[model samples]
Target: MRSPAPEREGDDTLVWNVACPTRPSSVPGVAMAGFSDRGRLPEGQRLIPHPAVTLVLDFGPAPPVVDAADGRRHRGSLVAGLGLGGALWARGDDLACVQVRLSPVTAGAALGVRPDELEGAVVPLDALWGRDAARIGERLGEAASWEERFALTDALLARRCAAATPANAVDPEVNRAWDRLVASRGRARVERLADEVGWSRKRLWSRFRAQVGMGPKRAAKLVRFDHAAHRLAAGHDTARVAAEGGYTDQSHLHRDVVAFTGVTPTGVARASFLTVDETAWPTLPLGGVNAGKTV
Candidate 1:
């Protein structure tokens, strides 16, 4: 049974319209989703910025295109490292893709590469995986159905995860720190996190940035902003959202929202991207009302 989940649409083109489930339990810090966008639109998509690194595997006629804020162009099945306040413009025809979100914790293992190498950049998957990336593409392209593709992806990730040791693969302390930030809804202080992780402030700062793609302070701020953005989308008042989201005041909250999304808090309240997230990633806090449903 296939379903339609429209990510965005217009008179000419469509992507992400087929509704489906992204089982989060398949891999740590990784979620699976698929989108089919065909037809030529003058523009394609503006990636909704999230804290997670996105690995997109495209099996369309031509690879998807990504124009980053810093004037970099990327194409094909690509891995986007952790981002800070930027949108990737995706444009082209036949933009079918399967995307996986990798938590900084699982990046080293799942990617067989390091997040630091890709931070603030988008690179073809082959760049990291060499021949394996091509093999995966061939397998995905030959799969008869989306379900099969999803299963293959799951198996690959599970195998990698099994091989990756928590301590040896990446800094376990950094993983714990990230968990704390997520648990606290991004409100946890880096200094406090350092104390808990048994690292000095400077060591934590350097190592966290090296592995996670951004310094701890910046990552925390981005996490906090994601939380606030969701609250605003859920129809909370700006002032209340601000206070609850850990801003000094409404003005502080306003600045952060604008900086992150290029929109005011009120503007974010009307974002459809967040609305789509409810069904796409149920475990995400933005996924409140639509949690645990597969269409």
Candidate 2:
């Protein structure tokens, strides 16, 4: 029931261990509620990639802005931010939950949905499961551990795959652009992307909006930020994160961190067990922060 905090007093980083609920105990391996403290993620100069499947539930009075580019808002007490080709942060909740990180293409194919079109939709997690919210809620309320919750999540994903249709397949162009953006992060310009994809800016924009729910530039930025965030979380210094991510300087990194998650670099890097994905390393510059910290 408690949310994760950014950091505790006397320390810079905070990690909350969330319990998985298990009363109706059917789904398995997923927590009923999880949240993270509204801490800032470090700034990086590079573009990041999105996690494959992210389930977000906001225990708030209103639907928060899930993505600035799509302008999609969610009012339901519980919503899912499933990323086919993007990253998302809850500017509202200090949260924690079991998120099954998968490859976008693999997850999409397995779910029978085009990874592109699912970019910014905040559909109910249970809706995707074809089960009533309370039914799933009961399962979560009874779940015992993170592993159990993950198992339940895998089952739910399987069910979703069975129910999917061709209508769910996203546009191929969207995937093409998404792949390029992921590969380049924020380093690639829109004009260059347009040329590579053989589409006018207008054409790309239309396709992007329809398939990915945002322009290529915004999506690229979010993806890039995710990569930088991973680096910061992994103990990379600020300057290094910025430079590697393609930022002009530490200020640029700071601005991006504040703009995306409303948190600062030092705040996120406080955690001692942060893990960095190597592919995302370029987003952070080397030897950027705490180079002088006394060992």
Instruction: Name model 2 segments beyond 4 Å from true.
Output: 1-14, 18-53, 56-77, 80-97, 101-131, 140-148, 268-295
What would the TM-scores of all predictions be? 0.83, 0.56
Candidate 1 residue-wise lDDT, 1-295, digit = tens:
2355443445332335443454444665666667675374347656656777777887767777888767878878888877523656778877677777667667777887777877657777898878888788788889888877888888988897788765326677888888787777778877899899999999999988888878988877778887787778788999999988889999999888777667788877766456556555655554221111111
Whole-model lDDT, candidate 1?
0.71
Best prediction by TM-score = 1
Report the lDDT of model 2 for residue 258.
Answer: 67
Q: After superposition, how far is residue 105 of candidate 1 from its true place, in Å?
A: 0.7
Question: Lowest lDDT 10-mer window, candidate 2?
Answer: 286-295
Q: Name the lDDT value of residue 291 in candidate 1.
A: 13
Cα lDDT tens digits, model 2, 86-138, are 22333333333443333343344334444354654545554544445446445
* Model 1, position 108: C-alpha lDDT score: 72
Which parts of model 1 are misplaced by more than 4 Å? 1-15, 19-25, 38-41, 162-168, 266-271, 287-295
For candidate 1, the per-residue lDDT at 38 reads 38
